[model samples]
Target: MTATTTADTPTAPQGHPRRWLILGVICLAQLTVVLDNTVLNVAIPSLTEELDATTSDIQWMINAYSLVQSGLLLTAGSAADRYGRKKMLAAGLALFGIGSLVAVLAGSTSQLIAARAGMGIGGALLLTTTLAVAMQIFTPDEHPKAIGIWSAVNALGFATGPLIGGFMIDHFWWGAIFLINLPVVALGLVAVVSLVPETKNPQGDRPDLLGALLSTIGMAALVFAIISGPEHGWASGRVLMTAAVAVAVLALFAYWESRAPYPMLDLHFFRNRKFTGAVTGAVLIAFGMSGALYLLTQHLQFVLGYGALEAGLRTAPLALVVVALNFSGLSAKWLARLGMPGSIALGMVLMSGGLVSIASLTEHGYGGTLLGLLLIGAGAAIANPAMAHAIMSAIPREKAGVGAGINGTLAEFGNGLGVAVLGAVLTSRFAALVPVAATSLPAALAAADSAEERERVTDAFSSGLETSQLMGAAAVLLGGLLAAALLRRAERAGDGRPGDGPAAGPDSPVGVSG
Candidate 1:
C-alpha cells in the first residue's frame, strides 16, 4: 500500500490516454458548483413569488450552501485522499445531481435550504478533490497548464451565473436554474466512473473524525457570524458570542491538527512561505473583489438605474477579461517571467489601481467604470492561476487534496467575510452621508417623495460606494506588499535544516519565490 501511482492508473504520457477527458469532467462538475454560488441571486424574485419565501428565508438559501461548503471542504479534501479521489468524485457528482433534483422539487423555503446544504456538501467534495485528481493525472510539466484551464473555467462559471440564471428566470420557472445542473452532473458521473483513475494516499492515517467535527463547526459558525454581523448589529451579544465560539473552536482545531495522527489539514504546510503567501493572497483577493463587486452591482442597479439583466450585461467586460487572460496562455508566461510572488504582487497592484479608478467614477462615467472593471478582471486573471500553481507546486503530490481543500476553505471564508465587512462599510457610510432631514433612503426613493430627496440619496449612496472601493483598494495593496515580503524572506532563508525553516525545495518551481 505504498503511496505510489498504481500500475493501471493513467498518466499524461501513458498509453491509456484519458487525462484531458478527466480534466473536462472535473471542470464540468466544478462549473456546476461554481454556478450555484451566484446563480440563485437572480432567481430570488421568482423564488419568493412562487414559494412565498420571506427575506430571512431567502438569505438562508444562499447562506446554507456557503456555510456547509466552507465548513466541510477541509474534511472532504482529506477524506478524498484517504478514501480515493475517483470514488469521492463519483459520489460527489451523484450527491450534487440528487441535491439539484431535490432543490427543483422543494415545496417550501426550508426544503430548499436543506437541498442547498446538500449541494454544498457535494460541491465541497468535488472541488476539494479536483486539484488532486488533476495533479495525479498530469506530469509536473503539464500541471500548470492544466491548472490554468481549470481556473479559467472556474472564473467563467461564476461570472456567467447571473446571466444564465436571469435567462432561465425570464423564460422558465426558477427551478430551471437547478435543473440545468443535472445534465452536467450526469456527464461528470460518467467521466469519473469510466475515464478517471483512482488515486489515494496509501500512507494516509485513519480519518480524524473529531478534528473534522471541530473544523466543520468552527468554519460554519465563523461564516455565519460574519454574514449575520451587519444585520444583527456588530456589537450585539449574539454576534460576539458566536464569534467567540468560532475563535475557540478554531483554536482547538489548530491544536488538534498539531497532534492528530491524521489531521484533516496538515498544519506544517504553512511552513512553506510560498504556500502560506499564496493562501493569504487568495483570501485578500477574494476579500477585495467580492466586496467591491457586491457594492458595484448595487451601484449599477440603484445608482445607474439598470435592470438586473442590464447590470449583469454591463459586468460582462470584466468577466471577458478574466476568461481571456486565463485561457490565452498569457498567465503561464507571466508566471514564468514574474515568479509567483512578483506575479501576485503585480496582479494586486493592478486590481488596487482599478479599484481606485472605480472610486473616482461619477454618475455619468460609464466609460470609467468599464475601464476599471477591465483592469480588475485582468489582475484577477493573472493572480488566480499563479496562486493555484504555487499551491500545487509547493506541496508534496501526496497531500494535494488536503492542500486543495485548505485553499478552497480559505477562499470561501474570505469571500463571505469580505461581503459582510464591506456591506457594513457601505451602510455606515450611507447613513452618515444622508441628509439629516431625510428619513429612509430606500423608502423615500421608492415613493418618489421629492426630487431633492432622490438626488441626495443617490449622491450619498455613490459616496458610500466610493468609500467602500477605497477600503478595498487599500486592502489589496497591503496584501500584495505582504506577499512580496514573505516570499523574499522565505527565499533568503533557503530550505535550511529539515523543519527548521520554510520548505522551498529544489523541486519547487523556478521563478516561484520560497
Candidate 2:
C-alpha cells in the first residue's frame, strides 16, 4: 500500500512509439462510448419518427442505456481486474460495434432498447479498462498530460455530440448516427489488438457477485422511479413502492460490499477526506452542469427558433473553451499547490454564480447567457484535473487503476442521477404551471377541453418550458452551495506528499480517517 519514490527512466514496454499509438486507439473507444450517451438524445426525435415510437418508448431508449451504464461500471471494474484489461478493451470495442449494427437494423423500440443495453455493457468494459491501461502504460511524470488529453477527448466527445447528431439527422436518417461509429470501431479494434498489453490482478480474488447484482438492481430501480415519478404522480403508490425497494436493495448492497472478500466496489476510500470531498464535490458540479445543459438545449430549440445544428454551434463557446483550457494544463499547478478542497470550492462558487446569469435566459436571444455558461464550463474544466491529482495522489501507484475506476463509476452514476432528478423537477414544475399556461392560450384553444384536443393542449404545453429553465437555475445554485461545503483547504491537510507539514499517508501510520 506504500508508494516507492523512484527516478529511474521508464521502460518503453517494447517502445514509447507503440504506447502512444495504442493510446489513440483507447481514446477512440472512449470517445465513441461517451459521445453515444448524449448524441442519441438529440437524435431521439428522428428515432421516434422512424420507429413509430410513443413518448414512453423513446424515454426508454435513453434511460435503458444510462441505467445499464450506471449500474455496472463498478462491477465492470472488478471484471477488468479479474479478466485481462487488454482483452476486455478489445472485446468491448468489437461488441459495441456489433451492438451498433443491431440498433441500425432494428425496426421496433424494444429491439433498439436491447441493442443500446448491449452497447452499454461494451461501453462499461471499455471505459474501465482504458483508464486502467493508460496508467499502466505511461510513466508517472507523463501520466497527467496523457490522462488530460484522454479526459479532454472524453469531454470533447460529449460536447461535440449534439452537433454531430444534428448534422446527421438533418442530412440523413437516424441510422446514420450509428453508422458513423463503424469506421472508428474498425480502426480501434486493429490498433488495440496489435498494441495494448494484457494485465490482470495477480491476486485473482473472487468478484463480489451478490454485491454487483444488488447494486445493478438498486440503481435501475432508483433511476426509473425518479424519472417516471413526474409522469406518474410522485405520490402514486407504484412510485412510492419503487422508491422503497430501491432503498432496501441499495442498503443490502452496502452491507454485502463491506463484508465481501473481493468487493466489486471498495467503500473504504471515503475514509480519506480528500477522496470523500473530491467525489462529493464532483457529484454536485455534475448535477448543476447536467441539469442546465438539458434545459438550455430545449430553450434554444423550442424558444429561440434555432435548428438543432445551430443550437449546438451557438453553445460551442463553453465546450470549445473547456477544450482549450484543459489542454493548457492551467489548473494542475494551482490545485497541486492549493490542494483539493480550495480549488473545488472556488470552482463550485464560480459555477453557481454563472448559473444565476444563465437563469435569466431569454427567448429573444442569447448574449450574457453564453458568458454565464462559459464560466460554468471553465469551472468544470479546472475542477476535473485538480480532483484527478488529489484522488490519485491519495492512492499508491499500484492501486492507481482501482482508484480511477472507482472515481469514474461514481462520476457516471452522478451524471445519470443529476439528469434524471433535475429533469424530473423541471417536468413537475412545468406541469404544476399548466393552469397558468392554459389561461394564456387562445380562448378557442383553451375552450376545446378534451384529451383529444391535441393541437391546443400541445400549444399550451410549450410555454411551460421557460419555467423549466428557471427551475434549472435554482437546481444549479443549490448544487453549488452543496459542492462548496464539501471543499476544505487541502493546504492544511496532513497528507505525506512532497510539501505536507505533518501529514499521515492515506494508508499509514494511522490510516485514513475522514
Candidate 3:
C-alpha cells in the first residue's frame, strides 16, 4: 500500500551528479554493515588472546549483533518509511560511528558487547533504508545496473572481510579492525548529507509501536530458542521453555500485526506467492550456505592447518566463480531464462550438492574434501545474487525498505542459525569424543597453563574439524533435496518483462559503476 505522504521525485543537482553520489553512499553503507558481520570473526582468536574472554562470550560478539539487528530490522524499516529514509540513514551512521569509537576504546568484554549492540542499531538502520533510498534515486531502466553494482560491491566487501581482518590481526591489535570503520563512515556521512534527499511514506501509516514490539520480541524469542537449543540439550527443560516462549511470541506478533492499524511487518505480503516463495527460498539458501561455510572454515584451519590467508585463499573459488558468473549473467538470459523460483531452486540445488559432496571428503584429507568446499562456494555465490534480485523484483518500490528489511534480516538469521545447528552438531559430537580422545592421547591434552594452552590450542582443534565438515555436508544435502523437491517453477518479474538484460529493476542498487 502506498503511503499518504507523497515523496518528491529526486532531481539532479547541477554540478553534483545525484546518482553517482547516492550510489557511493549506499555502497559505503552496505560495505560497512556486511563487512562487520564477518570481519569481527577473524579477530575472535586475537581478541581472546588480548582479553581473557570466554568462547561463549565471544560467540555473543557475533550473536549480539545478529540478535539486535534482526530484532529491530522490521521496526527500523517501518520507521524509515514513516519518518524519513535519509534522516534515519544518517542517524544509523552516526550511531555506528559512536559504537565503533566505543569498541576502539573498550577495556572490557561487556563494554565491547554493548558497543556492538549500538553498532547493530546503526547497521539495521542503514541496511533497511538503503533500498528505499536507491528506489528513490534511480529510474526503472537504470535501476538494474545500480542494483547490480550494489550487489557487486556487497560481494566485494564480504569477500574481502576475512582477508582484511586477517591482515589487520597480523599487523595490528584486534581493536584496529573496528577502528577502521571510521574513515568509511566519515565519507558516507558527508556524501549522504549533501546528496541524498529525505523520503517519507506517503501512506502515512502510524508507527505501530505495539506491532513493532511484538515482531521484535517474537523474532528474538525464535532466534534465541534456535541458538540456545544446541547449547542446552534440545530436549532439556530450558530448550523446551524457550521454544514454547518463541511459539507464543510469534503467535502474539502475528495476531497483533494482523489487527494493528499500521503494522511494523506487513503479514499480508505473504499473500503474494512470489514474495512468500522468494523469502522462503532466501532463508533456506542462507541456512544451507551458512551451515556449510561454518564447517568449511574449520576444515581449512583445523584439518588442513591453513593460516588465515591460506584458508581465505582456499575459499576464494566461491568469490571468483560468483564474479565470473555474475558478469556473464549480465549478458545471458538470466531473468528470462530461469525466472525467480527456477533460479532460486537451481542455486539451492547446486549449493546443496556441493555441500553434500563433503560427505565424500570425511574419510579423505585435503585432496578429497577440497573439491567439496569449492563446489559449495561456487554454488552459493551463483545463487545469492539471483535470490537477492528476485526478492527486490517481487515487491512494490514503495515498500522496498520493509521488504528489504525482511529479506536482509532473514539472510542474517539463516546464517546464524546455519552455524548454530551445524556447529552444535559438530560441537556435541566432538565434545562427547573429546573426553574419550583426550584420555586416550595424552599429547592432545593441555599442559599446566591449562587455559592458555587451550587458547593456543590449534592442533587439537584441527582434529575436531573433520566432525564439523561432516555435519556441514549433511545439512547442505538435506537443504538441497528439500529445495529441489519443493520449488516447482520459476517466477518472473512483477511486469513479466523479458529481460534478456540483467534481472534488476527500476529501483535496484548501485555497483562499482553507477
Give the clash count for each candidate: 0, 1, 17
Ordered by lDDT, highest first, the candidates read 1, 2, 3
Residue-level lDDT of model 2, residues 291-390, one tens digit each, is: 5675666556644557767776766676676677667876555555655566666666666666666665453348767877688777766666666555
Question: How well is each residue in 28-99 modelled by candidate 3, as lDDT tens digits?
Answer: 888888778777766655666577665445656776777678767777887877677888888888888888
Candidate 1 whole-model C-alpha lDDT, 0 to 1: 0.74
Regarding lDDT, does 1 or 2 come out ahead? 1
Identify the leading candidate in terms of lDDT: 1
lDDT of each: 0.74, 0.65, 0.63
Report RMSD for candidate 2.
Answer: 6.1
Name model 1 segments beyond 4 Å from true.
Answer: 1-16, 44-60, 107-110, 431-444, 496-514
What candidate 2 gets wrong by more than 4 Å, as runs, is: 1-20, 52-56, 435-514
Task: Specify the highest-TM-score model's number.
Answer: 1
The predictions' CA RMSDs to the true structure, in order, are 5.2, 6.1, 5.9
RMSD of candidate 3 to the truth, in angstroms, is 5.9
Error of 2 at 92 (Å): 1.6
